[model samples]
Target: MSQNTLFDKVWDLHKVADLPGGSSQLFIGLHLIHEVTSPQAFGALKDKNLNVKFPSRTIATVDHIVPTDNQSRPFKDTLAEQMIDTLEKNCKKHKIKFFNIGSGSQGIVHVVAPELGLTQPGMTIACGDSHTSTHGAFGSIAFGIGTSQVRDVLASQTLAMNKLKVRQIWCKNRLSEGVFAKDLVLHIINKLGVKAGVGYAYEFSGPAIDLLSMEERMTICNMSIEGGARCGYVNPDQITFKYIQERQFAPKNENWARAVEWWQSLASEKDAKYDDVVLIDASQVEPTVTWGITPGQSIGVSQKIPELKELSIDDQFIAGEAYEYMGLSPGQAIKNTPIDVCFIGSCTNGRISDLRVAAEIIQNHKVSPNVKAFVVPGSEKVAKAAIEEGLDKIFKEAGFQWREPGCSMCLAMNPDKLTGNQVSASSSNRNFKGRQGSPSGRTLLMSPAMVAAAAIEGKVSDVREFLKK
Candidate 1:
């Protein structure tokens, strides 16, 4: 067990009681709900004839099922429409705040919360969505819960869970231009293996993490689940306070100063103890992309696909699977692997900063004649910010469609889905089979800017080649 680390401090501070099953009943300070996962939990409450015990602590938003392109009354997809309606009705019934479609606050739950100041430093946030760890970037403890656990939070505002060991992932050195936090995380995942964090919480610290903006930190922590970590977080600092200071839901004036002090206290002490530690050099990290099904199967932009026989026996089998599914030959460079679609949105990297970075790559460079590319902001606020900065026009002029805000092609619950066996260069998280709403659709995960670079070349091109030095 770790001592004096942020994870230890936050867990102990919010622990309600020790449960009988070798787990602690942890208090959740913020509960974020989306359309897809909340319906059944709401139904469970209805079955019990119960109401949300702490409505103020929970916030509702429609994301997973909402259409990014055509969000009109009654979504074309029957199931999606039903989910929206269920969330709306449930939020109203429980007197919980709901950010519905067309509501400026509505977007992906993870994206909406931080931008709106709802996710604050030193808070413990939970959501039913796997990427709820996204909120951990604010130096908070965030967890992803199952539907039943969702019901638990709604009823009692607490979750029972065994405490996790802490892993200190220290990254020093500075990243090169065009090497964003997405690439940094992918680099870490590839080195550490996806399951390395199965029983641990990751504390992302050191110079590299310290340099990232709050949005970048969110992008890194957002996919901690993909790395098999229960949660991932950065210690609060000036950047954290600056991002939260003027947000809609954050503390103000004296409360603001008090909050910052408390947030500072949550950081691991200089001599903090940890169960494990891993060190990474950011300068050595490259612009990375997922070559196979898992986030751990990533490689550098300049690297070639590994031959099955060259890998460990277990990974050799995975390589074989990827070779068959991705239709790529071993030893072939991932560069120039053709793509048919380019999707740029998800809880992981769909914020305005991501858009701005991708837009720079998309500027003056047109999408390939055969490639279909589009940009979807993670939240209405992000969308508004992009538009204000004229990124929408830049994308449109570069032969990309600028869509409305929602989860978009990240999960493809909406109309923005990949067709048939067509492959994609996506900035979103998850490249699992059928994850993009097409049974045969293939996805290659990369940074938003890398997706932009590929969109222009119609292939897995190196973004560093296109970026200004």
Candidate 2:
């Protein structure tokens, strides 16, 4: 058990009561829903004839199955169209706010809410998507719920859960250029193992984390679920407040100052005790890429693949599976592995800052003829911001397609998918088998900048090489 940490504070604040079986009834302040997961939950509600308990606390959006390339009415995928329609109808029936397609706020649920200032510190947030932990960057407690849990929240605005032990991941030093928040998170996953945080909530703190922007913090916390943590968060600070202030849904004027004060108070006490702690030196972290199926099976871009004997027996088994699936031999360098497609978008890394960083690498360069590359903004706001800064043109001139906003290629529920056996340099999270639509497609997860460098070179080239140019 952790004491005096932000996780403890936030959890205790929102705890409605202690239930039987040692679980707590936790109140959720924000409920984010998307087309893919909400339809069934809404259907369950219809079956039970229960209206949304707190419609104003819930927000809806269409993202998962919407095509980034062509978002015209009546999506070509009949099922996708139906899901979107169902979400729209349900939102209307419940009178919940929905950020539908073409709405200026429409995008990935994770991406849309934060930019709108809907995710605030000390609140408990829940979404039906695995990456709902993305909202935890605001020093909030967020969890990804199953469909039944979605129904539960819609009916009662609360969830039953056991408390999580807290792990303080203290990062020191500063990241060098060409290395990024994505690379740092990959490094953490690789070192700690994917399941290390299984029964814990991760508190990412210290100099390295403090220096990161709110978006970077989001990227780190976004993948906490992949690391097997229930959630991850950073203590709210000036960076968090600055990012939230003036956003569409943020408190204004006197209330704004009071909100900041309360958020500041939620920070962990100096003498907080954690169940576990791990320290990482950011200076040692390099531009990283996932070489195998799981995010934990990653290595620095310039590093060689691990030999079976170099890994623990359990890791050896997983590595063997990876070697067979990825078709790469032991000791093969991750660098220079040829790639066919490059995708740069997702809730994980599709913010305006991510686009700017990728655009910086894509500028004055051309995508390799052998590679097909594209950029999808996380939200309509991000897309509009990039266009204002001319990042879209930079991408287009670099031989990359600039697509409309949605969760494009992240899960490949849409038209933007990898062809058979194509290896991808992706900025999005996850590299699971068949994750990018094609059963045989391979995905190599990397930072948006690294994806841009790979797109230019048509291989797993070192992004540092481009940064030095």
Candidate 3:
């Protein structure tokens, strides 16, 4: 058990009661819903004859099924159209706020909420998507829930769960030039191993984390679930408060000061005790890429894939499967592996800053003729910001398609998908088999800048080379 840590503070603050089964009844301050998961929970509510207990505390957005292209009403995919329609009706019936497509606030639920300031420090946030931990960047205790849990929150605004042990990952030093937060998180996942976080909540701290921007911190927390952590968070600081101060839903005037004061008090005490601690040197992390199925099966761009003997007994089986599925051999260099498609979008890395980084890299080079590349913003706000800065123009001029906002190729629920057996350089998280829609599609996860460099070279080239040039 951890003492005086941010996780403990937030959990204790929201704990409604200690249940008979040793689980705590935790009240969720924020509930974010999307088209894919809400339909079932809303249906469950209908079956039980219950209305949303706190409609105002819940916010709805359509993303998972909404196509980034041809978003015209009565979507070509009847199922997607039906799902969005059901969500609209449900929100209307419940009087919950819905950020529909073209609403200017519409986008991925994770991206939309934070940009709107709906995510604040010390709050317990839940979403039906795994990456809901993305909101934890604000020092909030946030995590994804199953459909049943979604129903629970809608009905009672609370969840029943055992507390997670806290692991303090103290990152020393700052990232070197050309290495971004994506690379750092990948490095963390690779070093810690994916399952190392199985029963813990990660507390990301130290100088390296402190130097990162809010969006970068979000990228770090967003993938905590992939590491098997229940949630991940950074202590809120000036960076967090500044990012939230003027947003649409953030506190204003006198209330703003009170909020910041309270938020500061929620940070982990200087003498906090954690169940575990791991130290890392962020400067050692290079531009990284996933070479195999799991995010943990990754290597630096300049490094070679692991040999079977190099892996532990438990990881060897999956490593073997990954090798065969990825069409990669042991000790093969990940660099210069030809890429067929380059995708830059998703809740993980579709912010305005991500687009700017990719655009800056792509501006001087055109996409290779052998590669298909595109950029999808995380939210309408991100899209609008990029357009204002002409990032879309830069992408288009570099032989990349600039698509509308949605989840895009992240999960490939939409039209943007990889064809059979195509190797993709993706900025989005996850490189699981068939994750990008095609049963045989191969995804290599990397930073947006790395994806841009790959798009230009038609291979997994070192982004540092581009940065140096």
Candidate 4:
């Protein structure tokens, strides 16, 4: 068991009682709901004749099924429209705050909460979406819950769960030029193997992590679930505090001072003990891209895919499957692999900073004639910020579409989807088969800058080349 780490501290702080089966009843400080998952839970609540236990603690938004292109009344996708309508009616009936489309706050549930200052240190946050671990970037204990657990949170505001062991992943040095948080996290997942984190909560720390901005930290934590970790977090510091200081829902005046004081105390002690620890040199990580089905099946853009014998026994089967699905040879280099679509958005890398980085790399360049490229901001606020800074103009002039804020092609629940066997250079997370809405569509995950570079070249190109000049 880990002791005195942020995970331990936050878990203990939120533990309401010891359940009979060695699991603790943990109180969720924040609950976030979306259109796709909340409808079923709300229906369950109606069957049980229950109301949201703490309406103010929960927030609602429509994201998963909302089309990024046409968001007019009565969505083109009838089911999507019904989902959003149900969420709206449920939120109103329960007196919960709902950030509807065009509210300027509505977007991906994960992206909207943090920007609004609803995600803070030492809180236990739960969402009905897998990326809820994104809130952990603020030194909180957060994780995704099933629909049943969503109902549990709404009805009682707590969950029964056993504690997870803590693993401290100490990154030694700063990332090299052109290597963003996305690349670093992909590298970490590749090295650790996806299931290495099955029973653990990852504590991401060290000088390398400390140097990242809040948005970058969010990117790292956002994909912890992809690595099979229950959740991931960075210790709160001046960087975290600065990011939260003046947001819409953040504490004000003297409350701000007190909040910071408390948050500062939540970092792990210098001598804290962890159940496990791993160390890596972040400076060595390069622009990374997924070549296979899972997030862990990735290599540096300049490296060749590993041969089956070169992979561990546990990974060989998946490697073979990935090779067939991706239509690539084991010894082939990932570079120059043709791409059909270029998508740059999602809770993973859809923030204003992400757009700015992609735009910078795309300046004076145009999307390849063979590629379909677009950028979807994470939220209405993110979209507004990018437009204010003229990012939209840069993208449009570079032959990329600047779409409305929503989850977009990350999951392909909307109109933005890949057709046939099209290959995509995507900044969004996940490369699972059929994940982009085409049974045969292939997705290669990379950083936003890398996605931009690929969009320009119509292949998997090293982003560092663009950074050199």
Candidate 5:
């Protein structure tokens, strides 16, 4: 059992009681909902005739099924229209705050909550979306639950789960030029294997992590679930406190100082014990991209795919499945894989920083023929900021469509979807089968800048090479 690590500390602090079946009854400080998942959860509550517990702690938004192209009410997709209507109805009945389209605050729920200061240090955040862990970048413990668990939180504001073991991932050295948090996480996931994090909550720390901005940290933590971890978080620091100091829900001047004091104290102690510790050299990580179905089936830009025999027996089986699905032979270099589309957005890497990096790369460059590329901001605020900086013009000039804020093409629940077997270079977190909206639609997961490079080349090309030229 780990002692005094951030996971253990947060768990112990928020644990309301120990429950039967070896699970703890943990209290949630924040509950975020979206149109897609919350509708069913709210319906379940109505079936049970139960009122939401602690409605003030919960916030709602529309993202997953929202169309980035046309967000007008009475949406073209009747299913999406119904979902948003349900959320509005539920929030009204429960007296909860909702950030709807035209509200200026509407966007991805995970992105909106933190930017608005609704997610704070030491809070236990939950949502019905995998990237809910994005909130953990603020030093909060955030969990992504299924629809059933969503109902649980909506009704009781409590969760039943076995405690997770804490794994300290210590990253040493500085990232090389052009590399970002997305690359570092892909490196970790590929090295650790997808299942290695199944029973743990990762504590992302060390010099490399410390150097990343709050948005960058969110990108790292957002994909924690992709590695199969139940949750992940960083310890609160001056950076964490600074990011939340002036936002709407965060404490005011004197209250912020007091909140900062409390938040700082939540950092894991120097001698804290952990279930395991893994050290990674940040200097060695290159621009990474996912070549196969799973997030773990990734390689550095300069590397080749692993031969199935070189992996563990189980991993070899997993690799075999991936190879068949991805239509890539073993030992082939991941570079120069043909791509038909490029996507930029999601809870993982859809912030203003991501857009800035991609637009910087595509500024004076033209996209290749037949490549359908676009950028979707994580929130209305991110889109507004990009327009303010002229990032939108750069992208448009490079032949990338600048769309409204939403989880566009990440899960393909909306109109922004891939056709046929066309492979996409995506900045979103997941690369699962049918993830980009087509069962046969392939996805290559990379950073936003890398996506831009792929878009310009119409293939899975090396981003660093473009920079050098």
Candidate 6:
């Protein structure tokens, strides 16, 4: 058990009661819904004749199935259009705030909420999507719930769950030039093994994490679920408060000071105890990439793939599977692997900072004629901001398609997908089999800047080489 940590404080503050089986009934301060997962939950509410317990606390948006290229109404995909329609109808019936297409606020559920200042420190946030832990970057305790839990929250505004142990991941040293936050998280997941954080809430602390911007911190927490942590968070500080201060839904004026004071108080005490602790030196992290299907099967760009015999028995089984599925051999150099597509988007890496990094590389560089490349902003606001800064022009002129905001190729629920056996250099998280729509397609996860470098070379090239230019 952990004490005096942010996880403990937020959990204790929101605990409504302890149930018979040792599960605590925790009240959720915010509920976010999306088209793909909400339809079934809203339908469940209809079967029970229940209305949202707190409509104002819930927000709705459409993202997964929305097309990034052609977003015309009455979507060509009948099922996608139906899903969006159901969400719109349900939000209207329940009187919940819905950011529909062309609303200027419409985007991925995760991106929309945070930008609107709906994600604040010390609040318990829940979403039907696994990456809901992204909101935890603001010092909140956030969780990704199942569809059944979604119904539970809508009807009662609370969840029953066992508490998690806290693991303090202390990062030290400053990241070297050309290394991005995405690379840091990938390095963490690669080192700790995917399941190391099971049953634990990760407390990302230390000077290295503090140096990261709010969006960069979000990138770290966003993939916390991928590392098998129940959730992950960083203590709120000046960076967090500055990011939230002028946003659309942030507390304003007289209330802003009170909010800041309360948020600051939620930080862990200097002598806080944790169940476990792991220290990592940020200087050792390079531009990292996922070489195999799982995020755990990753290696630095300059490194060679692991030999099967060198791995532990438990890891050998998956290594063989990865070798066959990825069409890669043991001890092969990870760089120079040809890629057919390059993508820069998703809740994980589609923030404005991500775009700026890629744009810096795309200037005076052209995408390889053999490669297909595109950039999809995470939200309408991100898209608008990028356009204002002329990032859109940089991408378009560099032979990359500039797309509208949505969860594009990240999941491939929409038209942005990889064809059979095509290899992709993707900025989005996850490299699972068949994750990018095509059953045989291969995905290599990397930072947005790495993806840009790959797009230019038509192969996996070291982004540091481009940074030097």
Minimum summed lDDT over a 10-residue window in model 2 is located at 312-321
Q: Give the per-residue lDDT of model 5 (tens digit) for 109-159.
A: 988999999999888999998788888888888989999899999899998
lDDT accuracy of residue 226 in candidate 3:
84
**lDDT tens digits, residue span 68-123, model 1:** 77889888889888888888888888889988877888888999999989998778
Among all windows of ten consecutive residues in candidate 3, which has the lowest summed lDDT?
62-71
lDDT of 2 by residue, 1-469 (tens): 7899999999999999998888999999999999888888988988999989999999998888888888999999899998999888899999999999888999999999999999999999999998998999999999798999999999999989999999999999999988999999999999999899898999999999999999999999999988999799999999999999999999999999899999999999999999999999999999999989999999998799999988888788788888988898999999999999999999999999999999999999999999999999999999999999999999999999999999989999888888888999999989998899899889999999999999999999999998788
lDDT of 1 at 108: 89
Assess the local accuracy of residue 393 in candidate 6 as a C-alpha lDDT between 0 and 100: 98
- Model 1 per-residue lDDT at 304: 85
Any residue pairs clashing in model 1, and if so which?
A: none
Candidate 6 lDDT score at position 340: 98
Angstrom error at residue 356, model 6 = 0.4
Candidate with better lDDT, 5 vs 6: 6
Candidate 4 residue-wise lDDT at 304: 98
What C-alpha lDDT, on a 0 to 100 scale, does residue 150 get in candidate 5? 93
Please give the TM-score that candidate 3 achieves against the real structure: 0.99
Candidate 3 contains a number of clashing pairs equal to 0
RMSD of each: 1.1, 0.7, 0.6, 0.6, 1.1, 0.7
lDDT by candidate, in order shown: 0.89, 0.94, 0.95, 0.95, 0.89, 0.94
How far off is residue 238 in model 5, in Å?
A: 1.7
Model 6 misplaced stretches (Cα beyond 4 Å): none
